[model samples]
Target chain A: MLKNIQEWVMVFLIIGAIILIGNWVGYDILPTAAIPGILTLIAICLLGLIIHRLLPFKLPSIAYIGILGFVLTIPGVPGSTYIVQWTNEVTLLAITTPILAYAGISIGGSWADFAKLGWKTIVVGMCVLIGTFMGSAIIAEIVLRFQGII
Target chain B: MAQQLQRLWKDWRLHTLVLAIVLLTEMIGTHEVSIGPGLILLLPMLYAVIIGIALFFTPLVNEKQTKHAEQLVFLSVTLLIAKFGVQAGPALPKLIAAGPALLLQEFGNLGTIFLALPVAILLGLKRETIGMTHSIGREANIALISDKYGFASPEGRGVMAMYIFGTVFGAIFMGLISGFLSSVTPMHPLSFAMATGIGSGSMAAAGLGPLVAAFPDMSEEIIAFSGASNLASTVTGLYMSIFIALPLTEKMYGWFRGKKDKNPTKIPSRNQRRCYKLC
Candidate 1:
């Protein structure tokens, strides 16, 4: 267990370093704030982990982490200004880039599994996709029309 | 402990590789291509596809490495979800103020399962496959369905098919369709963004990506509303699937086939007991 914890520490250190690099590159793209943004991000991840452990429900850790981050940044919170400053829109983009890329790599790894499902799977997939898109859109349209938000 | 450490190291290396590839592609794409107005939203997804396809063909990584890479999905999802939540935080009051409309939008997001049920039945799918197809078919759905029915079952096969499809094409489709709808439709961007957050994180990103590009100023509010809506979809959608959607789909399948099995096969308690004992 001690060795396992040590390994996780090492892994987090590597992740932290990667986040620094990502933030640096992000600075080039949207040159606003820098280190503080990275700090905010790390804090968010840590908080998310803690909350996930504490929560009883089996929902993903992201849900709790997001709620915590959101609540922390609300208007009346003590350090709301600092939190807002650190989590700039561009910083969010920087954070998203790696996640999306990881998603791509993950999908690539599953290619063999995907291929095994065959052509009928594609047909079923299309039906689901089209159904989801249309269903969501129709609901959105009705709500928008009724509310006159458009 | 040592084994766990080894696994962590493997995952760390895999994450590093993905990060490097993302950065490299982002730099190249930013320099070489001006993506323009319409295509700007799909930039991340495009990069993801390019890198993903390249990784798929290269065979530089072994199967174990790829499996490790897949584990990083939780990290990626957590980060994105937190960011979305934080962004959406201040907008919470506003979102709540518009509660009923938003709820309707969420119902619409879940409307796909109902629409897909008849078609799935028509395709000659079994009860398990039909149920799997009608559900959202995310990782959780797969775990739940597979655990209850076993991975070799028809339900497992159905969920796997949708999972692969959603993983491969869901992002691109959501991105493009949301972009098109936002531009052409008379609906509010907030509603459209909320609608995009049906369940999957990547799918929400794909839908929100274009909306963000189209309305840069409202990006935070858009993220907030969409994130909240996505969370709602994830939590509520799961229960709906288990208690409502799957059962409804099963009945629909029976009705469509015109030969309803009065006595569905129930796995014997003795068989379950034996399986547990073996485990």
Candidate 2:
């Protein structure tokens, strides 16, 4: 478990550094300025992972990670001001850049696996992808209209 | 042992490539072009995916390194989850206010098999359609199908095909759709935002990039609502897949194929009713 945490810290720290650089180049948040926010984000992720490990029942740590971040930064929570302010300095798009890049790299050799899926699978996959988005969007639009929220 | 493992961190190839990709893409910035009523909002994240994929073909990348790159994705997205979660926090009240729409959105999620299953059948995909059409075929969907059917099952291949497609094209495709939808649809930014939370990390970020860009004023709400909806999707998706999505897809698969699903109850014993009251 300690080893696992150690590896995670390494990955998160690496990602945090990339996020800082991207923020600097794209949004001009400055690597120095964003450090505290980056640290806060990392801390929350670690905390969530720890909680997930300690839990008697299994739960997705992603949920814990998200919940901890949300609970800690909610309007009236202690330290909420600092947490919110610092994290806000980190650009959302800047964060996604490295994540997706890694995603792209991870599958470079695996294109063959995709090709193996063939045209039938490709068409079906597209149908699933578009269907999910449109199905949800259509439903949400209806609810929004009926609720007059639109 | 620790020392050797630590040396893996020195493998700067992974970090350097990702760093370069992020820096270059962010510099390119966001560009929105109107092709008729459809707006194509090109985002840096989109570029990052493309560049990363392109980088793979070059001598700089190899299969082993790229495989490890895949492992990092699950870890990396937590930071994104935290970021989105923070956005959802302050806007908790607004999310609750949109509660009914949020609730019904899960039904829309279950509705995907309805669209996908038919097409899979038309395309001559057999039992594999069950896994592919189920739940947009994210990692969890892969697990759910593999657990029940084993990874070698046709259903498993169905899920995996969609999963691979999602990994490669989910972000780009969703980005285009979201961007175009934002400009053309009369639905508010919030509706589009809710759709952005299509139950995955890259897709959520990529989907919302355009919505947030298109409706800058509603960016915060867009982020917040989607974050909450994503959480809902992640949580409910498992239960929905187990109870609703799988059964519905299996039932629909039989109906669509006309000759398949000889038993109707494949493995889960739906006739056992898996219920006391609902049946």
Candidate 3:
């Protein structure tokens, strides 16, 4: 993995470079690349599999999800009120529930594992999130109080 | 591949179980109430954050336990980004204005570093494991690779190619969706494009403006419909992408000639030390 880090870095750099060039070109080329990039990734991965003789009849579940996600993202009619409102509503739910759910479950599971450490992991993770926010708020309040900004 | 499948199965059960509980809670909690639209929409976003934390902390148990776990995490996070990116649409000016400060605050998450220092010592997950957790680039690299190649035989060149591919497509998909939605409604293509970039990455979302600009004009009201559709497509698209990747990868694996290792490699322990690249 360490040996490959440089390659990853180069990829990111290329991405950044592309962004810079796009900015100069001032075209919406950035988002347009999503389709090409996704297709390319799938193609390359498939190609790699083929080379390695690892291409199975059925694709991995993740690959399926990626395809589904791409399909779901297809553009609707250029202008439709119903589409906008619905997407807004859906976007809200999509953004919120899964992440919180993931956190809740992952944390909850960690808490289960935390038992082996006798509550320490739970305490720490909780504090890092909850505590940091609370601490920041409190400090903000204190500074506000001193400055009479509250 | 079976090892990844087994891990995914475990996560699915876990995810389902948790979501079920959340759904039940929402029903029971909201039954007596007629919530406002703002609050109603807020529920999922908040839920995502909560779940994201859960997923983040859910330990790997071992390195190869579920190769899919990492992908799921990425998908979950991507979803969160999409959700917030769209919702935050109304607040674009403010967020951009505060972008610098926000960036600083992001840096200040280094506070979590202190938390890690002590917890890692206490939990016995070596300093290295804890360190890796904090490193975004490392996490990205791991995520990009693991999604394609399992622990048995990670093809770095292959994974890199895919990451580049995924990033670009995700961006375009997001851009198109954003542009499409913005055409019909008051929503901005830039926001959607940015969200797409963030959700998928910049390379893909960067191309959205022209696609959006090219759409036929409808009366503003009709354009609103397009906006709604765009929003749905973007959000749903992100979710579907995640689901698609997992099953497709598994299917592809099955079709390929690799035999399932009866005794696959063990997952790396949380505290286990491993070299991480900073650059």
Candidate 4:
């Protein structure tokens, strides 16, 4: 358990450093603000972990963190402006890039298992893909048209 | 819990290596190619696939390293989702205003699952495979099915296959389809973004990428809606899958086949294991 905690600390430190460097090079936020912003994110994530554990229903920690982050930025909340300012400086794409990359590597790692699933799997996948795309598009068209957003 | 934590920690080194490689690739891609807006949206998944394939062939990443990368995925997903939630915070009012439409659109996202279930049954798939393929295949779906039914069950195998398929191709397909849909269809960008959020973070990103590129002006709002929609899908979609979709699939299968297999195979309980070492 101690080793796990230590590894987590290292992971956070590495991620924190990357966020700071990205901010500096991209001019997304000032160096002074970057640390606080990243720290705020880390704290929120931890809080989310606690909340997820406490809940009776199984929920992903990300749901709790997202809700917390959103609540903190509401207009009337204390420190809302500061949180918004700091968060605003962080680019969404920058955060997703590494995550997506990691996802890619994970997928690659499972190639052998994936191949074993056979051609039937492809047909199943394609069916899901087409169904989701068409369903979403059809729903969106109807809703947007009804709402006059189209 | 201790064992789970240990497994998560064991992969930290590999996670760090993967992060470094991702960063380097992003830097090079940004510098070398001003990929047109249409193509730029595909970069993340494309780069991920390229790096993944390269790593798959290379000796540098062994099974242990791959396991580590897989373990670290939740961290990245959590960060991305949280950031999205934060971005979506201010747009709460907009989402509320569009609530009814959004809800209906969510049902639409699930429509495919219902469609797939019957077809899968008619195609002669087992009940387990039918239930697995009937829903949007994501990590949570895997855990849920694996916990309820042992990993060795046909349902477990079905989800495993779909999970692999989704992980490998779902995002890429979503990116391309969203881009195509936005151009050809008259759907609102916000609707498209919201639709993209049907459960999976990568799929959400893939769908959002094109919409954001197409309507750069509404990027913030689009992200907000997508985030909120994704959240709704994750929370509500899980229960819906557990209660409604799975059962419905079984019923539909029976209706089509004219018989029901009351005794679905149940494997004896053992130490729960992930379906794939790297997944």
What lDDT does each candidate get? 0.66, 0.82, 0.32, 0.68
Listed models, DockQ each: 0.51, 0.64, 0.09, 0.49
Across B31-51, the per-residue lDDT of candidate 3 in tens digits comes to: 111233211112222333344
Residue B272 in candidate 3, Cα distance off native in Å: 20
lDDT, model 4, position B269: 28
Off by over 4 Å in 1: A1-32, B1-13, B28-41, B126-129, B147-150, B259-279
What is the docking quality class of candidate 3? Answer: incorrect
Candidate 4 lDDT, B12-118, residue by residue in tens: 66656656665565554432222343233454445655586567667767776666666566666666676776777677778777787777776776676666766
- Model 2, B204-261: lDDT tens per residue? 8888888877777877788888888888887787888899989888877767666554
What digit string (tens of lDDT, one per residue) describes model 2 on residues A1-150? 788679778878998999999999988888999999999998998898889999976679888988888888788988888988888888787888888898888767667787776887777777777778877888888998898887
RMSD of candidates 1 onward, in order: 5.1, 4.7, 19.7, 6.4
Candidate 3 lDDT for residue B244 = 42
Which wins on TM-score, candidate 3 or candidate 4?
A: 4
* Position A70, candidate 4: lDDT: 85
iRMS, candidate 2, in Å: value is 1.9
Candidate 1: pairs in clash = B88-B224
Q: What is the lDDT for B125 in model 2? A: 77
Worst 10 residues of 4 chain A by lDDT: A19-28
Highest TM-score: give the candidate number. Answer: 2
